[model samples]
Target: MALKFHIVNRIREQVKAQGDKTALRFQTAKGWGDISWRQFGQRIDDISRAMLVSGLAVQDKIAIFANNCPEWTITDMAALQIRCVPVPIYPTNTPDQTAYILKDAGARVLFVGDQTHADIAMSIAEQCPALEHIISFNENVDFAGHPMGMSWEAFMALGNDNVEQELQTRIADAAMDDLTTLIYTSGTTGEPKGVMLDYANFAAQLESHDKVLSISENEVSLAFLPLSHVFERCWTLFVLHNGATNCYLSNTNAVREALQEVQPTVMCAVPRFYEKIYSAVHEKVATANPVKKGMFHAAVTIGNKMATSIQQGKKPSALLQASYRMADKLVLSKLRQLLGGQIKMMPCGGAKLEPTIGRFFHAIGINVKLGYGMTETTATVSCWDSATFDADSIGLAMPGAQVKIGKNNEILVRGPMVMRGYFNKPKETAETFTEDGYLKTGDAGHIDAAGNLFITDRIKELMKTSGGKYIAPQVIEGKLGKDHFIEQIAVVADARHFVSALVVPCFETLEGWAKELNIKYHDRMDLIKHSDVVEMFEKRITELQKELAKFEQVKKFTLLPSEFSMTNGELTPTLKLRRKVILERYKKQIEAMYKKHM
Candidate 1:
C-alpha cells in the first residue's frame, strides 16, 4: 500500500471520488456536524488558497493552539499542501509554554481555536518577533496591534482564489524528506524542544502500522486524544489515508458519552484513560448489593476461567463452554454495551499500562493493547495484535522498524518513522543517535525470544536508594496500579532511607469501599482521612509487598484526595505524573511520611 504521508493532495482526490461520503464529523457548542469528502477537499483547497492569498510563504511556520477540531485539521492540511511546516502547541500548555514554542519555532502566523487561546496568544504576541498574523477560529475578540486577521468563516472566502495548479507545483516541492510538522516535546525539565518530523517519517510510521493492524474504510476512529501531540496527529493521518471515518469526541470531559454516541470501531487513548475505565468498572462491581455482587463475581470467574483455559490452548468441556457463553451474554455483553459495543481496539500509549489490567481487559472482550513509541519517532515503533498479546511487553517492533539492545540495556531503534532532528538544534539532534544513527529510546528493557519488546522502566524513571538498591519504579508502579482502589501512584524513593509511594486513590472507587464499611466523611479530603480508607490501602500495600524485594517494598505511603490533573502542575499534558513537581509540591507530606527531622 502506498503511504500518502503528505495528506493534502490525497484529500483533494478523495474529495473528487468520495465527495458525498462523510469525511469528518466535528462537534460544536450547539451540537455536532459533518462535511462530505468533496466539501472537505474543497475546504482544504480553500484554506490553502487563503494562506497563499494571505501571503504564507514556503518553509514558513504557523502555530495552531487548539483542541482537536475540523479547523485544526484543515489548517494543518493547508500548511502541508503549501510546503509549510505546521507546529501545534498543546491547549493544556500554559501561556508560558505557548510563548516559548511560538518564539522558538519562529512561527510567522498563529491560529487560535477560541477566546481562551486567542487571549493567551495575544498576551504573548509582543514577544514573538516572527508572529505577524493572527487567525481566530471564531469571532469573539479583536486584537490591538494585530497586522492581519480573519475569522474561520471569513478565511474560507480568501481560499476562493484560483491557485489549484500553483498549489500542486508547491506540493511537488515537498520532498518525502521535507519537514512537515514541528511537534514540541513536553519538556519535563527546561524549554520545550521542537521535534522536526518529515514527510517520509510520517509515511513510514502509518504504512508500517497498517501492515500490522487491519484498518480500512470500514473502520471508524472516535478520537479524544489531543491532536497537538504526535500520537493523535499521526493516528488521525493514518486513519484518513486508510479511508477510515473519524468522529471527533465531544470533549475530553464527555468521552464516555461520545463513546456511546459514535460507537467507533477504533479509538486512540492514553494508558491513564484506560486505567480510569478499568477502575470505574471495578468500582461498579465492588459496590453492588450482595446478590448483584455475587452474580458479577460468578460471571467474572466464568469469564476468566474460559479466557485462561482458551489462552492456554485447552478446549473446555461443553458444559463449561455453555456456562461461559451464558455469562458472556448476561454480564460481559452488558459491559461492552456501555462502550457502545463497537470498540474493536484501542491502541494505548504515552505511558506503561498495567499487565494485569491488560489481561483482564482482554478477558472482558476489550482490546486495550500496549503499543510503544514517542513524539520524536512520529509515534510508531512497536504495536501488538489483539489475539497474540504479551501482557508485559510492547509487542513486536513494527514492520520496517529495527530494535536492538544498546550498551547499557537501552533500546535502540532505526526506522523511517524517526524524526529528522530537533529543529535548529544540531548538537541536541546529533547526541540523540548512535555512531551508526539508531535512535536511543531512553527506555531500559530487553526484547523477548519471540521479538516482543518488554519495557522494564524509563531509563530516567529508575531510582537508586541511599543504600544503592536500584528499583525500576514503573515495574512496581504498574504492579500497584493493578489494584482498583489506588487510582494513580508515583513510587518515590530517590536518595531516601527507603522506598515510599505517593498514592492518588481512585476516589469514586475508594469512596464506595468506605461507605460499604460505614466509613463516614465530608468530601474527598475527609474521606481520604478516614481510618477505613487508610486501612484499605495499608492492607493493599501489605498484600502487594510480599511480591517485592525488601528494599523495593513501599515502606510508607500518603493517599491524595484527587486525581493528578493536567491543569495542576503535578501532571504533564500527556498525563504522565510529573514526579519532580509531585515531590516538590508534597514535600511536607513526603517528609511527614518518612518522619524526617527538619
Candidate 2:
C-alpha cells in the first residue's frame, strides 16, 4: 500500500473521493449526527486558517486539553496541517499537571473541550505566559471578560476572513520529518516526560499495523479511549486512513450503551474493558440453572476446540463444526451481543491481560488482538495474528521493527516507529536508548524460538526477597487478578521475607458472596474488614496462587476497600498500576504482613 507522508494529505484525498461519506459521528440530544469527509476537510481548513490569522507560525506549539470528541481530532489535524506541533494533555489531569505540560511545551494556543477543561486552562493561563489564545469547543463557555478567550465558532469566523490558499501552502510545506505531536507519558514513576513524535513515526505505525491487520472502509470504529494517548490516536488515524467512519463516545460511562447503538466493527481498548466483560459473562453464567450452566460450558468447550483447529491451520472435525454452530446459536451468540453483535476485531494494549481472558474472548468469536508498545514507540510494536495467535505471548514484532532481548532480559526495539526523542530533555533521551540505538523498553521479558514476546515484569519493578530471590510482581499480579473476587492487586516483595499483596476486591461480586453467606456490613470499608469476608478472600487468594513458583506466590495480603484509581494516584490513566505510588501509600499494610513471622 502506498502511504501518504503527511496525515492531512490522506484526509484531503479521502475528501476528494468520498466527499459525502461519513468521516466522523458524534452523539447529540436528538441522536447521533455525522460530518461528511468534505465537511471534515473544510473544518480542518478553517481551523488551520484561524491558526495562521492568530499570528501562529510553522512549528508553533499548540495544546489540546480535552476528552475524546470530534473536536479534539479536528483541532489536532488542523494544527498539523499548518506545520505546527500539537501537544495533547489528558483531560483527567489536574490544573497542576495540565499547567506543567502547557508551560513545558511552550504552547502558544490552547483549545479547551468543555467548561471543565476551560476552567483548568483559564486557571493556569497566567502560569503559561506563552498561551495567548484560548478557544473553547463548547459554545456555552462564557469567557466574556477574558481578552484571550473565544468560542470555536468565533475562532472559525476569523478563518472566513482569510483565503484558503494560505492554508494549502502550509500543508504543502509539511514533511515526514516534521514534529507532529508531543505526547506526554503518564509515567508510572517520576515526572511525566514529553515523547516527541514526528510524522514518519506515526507513518511507520500506520504501515507496520497494516502488515498484521487489515481494515476497510466498511469498518466502523468506536473511540472511547483517550486520544491523547498514542494507541487511540494512531488507531483513529488508521480508521480514517482506510476511509472508515469513526464514532466518538462523549462519556466512557455510556460505553456499553454506545457499543450496541453504534455496533462498531473495530475497537481499541485496555485490558480493564475486556476483564469487565469477561467477569460479567461468567457472573451471569454462574447464576443460571444447572442445565443452562451445563449448556454454557459445553458450548465453550466446542468453541475452544474450533478455535484451536482454526489457529493451527487445520479444519475442525465435521462433528466439531456442527457442534460449534449449535454452540454459537445456544451460547456464544448472546455473548457477542454485548459488544453490539458486529465486533470483528478488538486491539487490546496498555496493560497485561490474563491469557485465560484473551482465550475466552477468542473462543467466543471476538478477536482480541493483545499487543505491546509504549509512548516512545508510537503505541504498537507487536500484536497477535488472528489466524495463528498464542494467548500467552504478544505476537511477533511488527514488520520493519527489530526486537531483541537485551541485558537483564529487557526487551529492546529498533524501528521507524521509535520516537525521535523526549522534548527538551537530551540527557533523559540519551539514557532511553542503547549505544546500538535500540530503544530500551525497560520491560523484562524474553522472545521464544517461535518469535513471540512474553513480558514478565518491569525491570524497575522486580522485587528482591531477603532470601535473595527475584520476584516479578506483574507475573504474580496477572495470575492473582484472574479470580472474580479480586479487582486490583499490587505485589510487594522487595527486600521482604515473602511476597504479599494489597488487593482491592471486586465489590459487586464480593457483596453477592456476602449476601449468600449472611455476612453483615454497612459499607465497602466495613465489609472489607469483616472477619468472614477477609477469610473468604484469604482462601481464594491461596487457591489462585497454586500455579506460581514457591518464591513467587503471594503468601499474605491486605484487602482494601477501594479500587486504585487515577484520581487517587494509584493507577495511570491507561489503568496500569503505579507501583511506586502504591507501595508508598500502603507501606504500613505491606510491612504488617511480614511482621507476624518476625
Candidate 3:
C-alpha cells in the first residue's frame, strides 16, 4: 500500500517498521558489512538536503554516473524524495557519451563513482555547459583542486546545518505526474534517447509485479546488474518496497564469490548471467571422471522430468520423485551450491534465454523466470508465475498490462507502466506508438492459446537472404551460442546468398582441447583457423543446424580472436549485440563467405 506513493514512501515505511534491521549489505576487503534501514533513511535525508544545498531545485536534472553500489541507490532515492529527476549514465560510456547525456538532460549536478568518473566529468565540463557541480562518491579520491568538483564528505557536510523540515515538505508535495527519472536507452543503433518515466509508471509496475511475484520480508536479494539500467533499477525499487535485504556486489568480476557469500533467496539477472553459469557447470562436468559424469547426466535427466511435471501442476511419478531426491543429494545439490544454495526465484530479462538452459536450471529446482520488456515499458511487460511457468515463453502479461500481437507480429503493449514519451523527441515518440494507444514494442513474437508469449526476434533485426527467405538471427545465434566452445556469435544473413556467422570462441576451453589433441598454436587467431579446429566447430554446427530450417542454419562461420565488447562499439551497455556495428566491423569476412559460394 505504501508503494502507491513515491518510492521514497516505501523506504520511510521500512524505517518505521524495522528501524534497526539490516537493509543493505556490501562486501568489504575483509568481509561483509551492512547498513540498517534507519541509517539508510537518514542518508537519503542528508543527501537530499545536500542536493538542495548544492543548488538542486525541484524538477532539476541530476545525473549519477556510477556503478552498482550503495551510493547509486542512495542518490536515486534522494532525487525521488525531493522530486528531482535523476538521469543515470552507464559507467562504461566514454567522455563523449557522458557529455551528450549531461547536456541533453541539462543536468545541474553530477555524482561520480570515483576519481576516474570525476576526471571524465571534468574533461567534458566545457561541453556540458549546464552541468554546474560535480560530487565524488569516493571520499578518498584526490580532487587536485578541480574548480567545480567536491568530495562527498564536503558535500554531505553542507547539509549538517540544515533541518529535516525542508526535505519533509518536499516529500509531502510529491505527485504522481511529476517526472521521476530520465532513463536513456543504450542506443544499439544510434544516439541514446531519454525515456521519461513518472510515479504512476512505477506504481503500475509495483501493482503488476505483485500479481506475479511474492517476496517475503525475510527474503534477501543480490544486486549485481548495473543500477543505471531499468531492469535492475526498477527491481531494486521493488526489493526496497517489499522491505527485503539487498546485498550489493561492488565488483561484477567477483560475482561467483559474492553469490556464495550472499546466497540470496531472490535475484534478478539477464540471460547472459545464466548462460555463463550454465557454461561453467558444463565445462567443469566435462572434466569429471566417467562415473561422475554419468551421475551428473542422470541427475539432470531426472531433474528435468520432475521440473516438467511441477511446471504443469502435476505430481511427479513416485519413481521419478524418488530419483530426484537421490539426484539432488548427489549432483543437483552441488550445482545449487555455486549459486549460494538458496535461490528460490530468479527473474531473467534483457535478452533471450534459451529454453534448454531454462530446463537445465529448473530441473535442479532453480526457478529461472524468463521475462520480456524494454526501457520504454518500465521493465516488466510479461513474466512467468511460479506455478504456471513455461520455459519457451515469457509467460502471461503482467496484471494491469495489455499485450497483443499486432501487424507483422510485433508485440504491442498498452498499460500504465508504459513511459509518458521520449524526452525532447516528439517525432520519434510519435512514431514509436500506433494510431491506437498501444506502444510498439518492435519485438516480433506470438502468444499461444495458453497466453504464453514466445519472442521470435527484433523486427528490425530480421534479415532476408538473397534467395528471399527471412531468418531470425537471434534464434539461430541463441541456438549456437549455447555451445560449450562458442562464447559469442552473431549470425550474418542480410542480403547474403547463405547464412554465415562471426564467432568468438571460448579461448580457455579451446586451448585445453587443443593441448589434449596435441594441436600446436601460437595464439587465438592461429587456433581459430586451424583445419582440425575448424572441423570440430563444423561438426558441432552441423549437429545444431539439424534443428533449424536449411536457410536459417549458418552455412559458414569465421571465428575472431577478440570478443565483442561495449568499449569496442560492438555491444550495448546491457550486453546486447550492436548488429550494425558488428556487421560493419566484419564486412570483409562476411563478403568472403559469399564470394567463395558464388
Clashing pairs in 3: none
Q: Who is ahead in lDDT, 1 or 2? A: 2
Model 2 — TM-score against the truth? 0.98
Candidate 3 lands at a TM-score of 0.98
lDDT of each: 0.81, 0.89, 0.89
Off by over 4 Å in 1: 1-5, 141-149, 301-321, 515-523, 596-598
Candidate number with the higher TM-score (1 or 3): 3
lDDT of 1 by residue, 340-363 (tens): 898888788987887767777777
Off by over 4 Å in 2: 1-3, 161-163
lDDT by residue (1-598, candidate 3, tens digit) is: 2445467777788888988888999878789999999999988888898887776788999999987788889889998898999999999998989998999999999999977888899889989888888999888777688888898778888885464677888988888888999999986788899999999899889777877898877889999899999999998899988899988886899988898888999999998888888888898899899999999999999988887788788978889878889999998998999899999999999988988898898988898888899999999899877777678888889988899999999999998999999999999999999898899999999999988898999999999998999999989988988888989999998888899999899998899999999999888899998999999999998997788998899988998999999888899999989999998988898888878999
- Return the candidate ranking by TM-score, descending: 3, 2, 1
Candidate 2's error at 425, in angstroms?
0.5
Q: Among all windows of ten consecutive residues in candidate 3, which has the lowest summed lDDT?
A: 1-10
RMSD of model 3 against the true structure: 1.3
lDDT assessment of candidate 1: 0.81
